[model samples]
Target: MELVINKILNEEDFELYLKTVESFDIINPFYKLLASNIEELLNDKLRYFTLKNDDGEVLVLMPFILRKVPYLEDGQVYYDVISPYGYSGPLFNQDMSRGHLITFWKLVDEWYKANNIISEFVRFSLNHNFQFYSGVLIPTLSNVRGAILDEETQWSNLKQKVRTNYRKGASNELRADIVDGVKPEDVERFYRIYISTMKRVNADTDYFYSLDYFKNIARLSKGKILITFIYKDDTPISTELILISGNTLYSYLGGTLMDFFNLRPNDFLKVEVMKWARKRNFKYYNLGGGRVDFDSLYSYKKSFFPNDEDVIFYTGRKIIDKEVYDKLDKIMNAEVYLEKEEVMEEENDSKISFFPAYRRNAFNR
Candidate 1:
């Protein structure tokens, strides 16, 4: 059987791509409808590739953004294919045999080569959509657990300490409201608190999102994005942005005031979010992974799903053009590259762990 691989380029095919995503239950909200808004705000190009049967029924879809590698001059074209900011890899609706997977990958490799895509990075969804999809892609599974919402015993599953924090916040007069979409004022408040939280943690500048970014996300998500803001006497203390895809809610981005940390607003915020998801009949509330597995942050999220096992987040990277990749690598690490701007720093021959190291600091503002 011949599998037709189609690349969706302009608006004409983009409309069909969106319709196809809406028709299938194979992807999360990030890949389904939010990718467009994200691309618009980030000023990146969307590259959607799909595989279909001979009958024209779509079988697999891999949506990625072609991010240009910065600091490179003209004629030295290279790109890194990355999933848009969240959990999305390749989505497959039908069961595919090993042969099918291999053939699809071969065709994808050809497409990547023709497009000058030097490397690919993917973050797989935790909803079990693309699990065990082994072919040429290998993913590193993380030790993280997504908190499941159990109608019967979701509350009972929480750790005693977690419940105590939840109560503490309530007793301290902390409250939260789940808004349909993040309002302009709330976006401002969220960004202020979010920036403060980032500064508190000494986070890299790359993690700091602009106010316009949040606004665009809310606009793009349509009604799929929800914001729960924790307030202490009319003053916003913490806020979380949740993304709904199918029957699951992802606790995507959040921020809490460092001064009010003792009030346990963040803890109460999670409890309230879970309760809302439960009442709305959501199956899971994916409290995302921490900086490291089983760390303090992960432990806090894990306490909510005491009866359920931890969910592993998977990631994969593929080098599409090894020769071009090596050339870029050499250029990035070369003395000439470093001396181009008359920089003063000791050069280390040791390789950095960043993927396609040439574009490592591309996001550093």
Candidate 2:
């Protein structure tokens, strides 16, 4: 079957494909629903592509943002379909086959070089089947890839680990205080814990989002974000933020004050969260993927979240207009976030607002 690729450039087109892609079970961003006013968020410098056969059967889908190096572009363009958080890649329709893919890639290659974006397409270590995918794409699989999986009948869960750890830690009374009400003030404490954890791991703060970003998401996402703080003795030793949308309650973020490590606060925290979900009758908990098979982080995530959701990722690229792309590559490689930025980053020692209105008012000199 003859195959052709087209970019989504209209409101009608976006909606049509969105409904079509839902059957694939891929997670579409909530922002996508508000495509009209928030095109920047949905398409946002992104180039969404659609592939179909001669019979007009939707074969495969790929959407990427035009990652424009504005300073270097000198007014040129190069783009790759990417995910901001997760589950943003390809959408293959029913008619997908090897032959159609080959044709589509040739077109992509010709298009990329023709556009003068690059010599070839590069996808950042993204897709599982890199061998089959061609054109301008490099799958970036190395950047902390993981899956949400439930352990087999044999593997130990998080609760079991906690029990063992509690014995090891020789804890006092293992109690959990559940707070039904959630507040914005909690996010600040959560950020502190997350920031502290990141510092412990020597991670970059770029991944650490600002409070405004969190506040914006919480406000805009409607009832999608469900946050639960687990406490013991009226003190929050550990807390977990679970993003609830549809049937999945993704164990999104968690942090703890190191002082309560003795009571196995984390283990207890996980169990309580799991119990809440089971009580409320939620389906899945996205424990998230580990860096590699059997990594320590993966092992830790496994204790509470055992459902292994094998998510599919899609990517492709092409040197659309070769003359335009060669310069683009040089420009892309040349750009880098300098190391000095880190050296200059010092923790704020002065009193500042942590969150709530009262806190901000109290801190303001």
Best by TM-score: 1
The sequence of per-residue lDDT tens digits that candidate 2 reaches over residues 1-365 is 43344345666666665665554543333324223224444544545555666776666655554444333344544443333344444555334466666666566556555554333233322234344566434332222222223333212433476557644433555555544444577667666776676676777655566665555545544456666654556666677665654566656666777777767777766555556666676666565556554578766765553444343233344333445444443443342334522322342421111211111122120
Off by over 4 Å in 1: 1-16, 33-44, 69-76, 94-100, 127-152, 181-189, 335-352, 358-365
**lDDT of model 2, residue 330:** 40
lDDT for each residue of candidate 1 in 1-365, tens digit (9 for 90 to 100): 34444445555666677787766754577875444454343463676667777887767777777777654657676677777667777676655654555566678777778877888877777755444443234434444444555645666777898789989999999988988756788778778888888989998876877777788667657678888999999888999888888787878788888889899998799888877877787777778766766667777777777667667766666787787777776666564444632332343322214565555444420
Indicate the residue-level lDDT of 275 in model 1. 79
List lDDT for all candidates, in order: 0.70, 0.49
Per-residue lDDT value at 320 in model 2: 39
Clashes of each: 1, 53
Candidate 1 worst ten-residue window by lDDT: 343-352
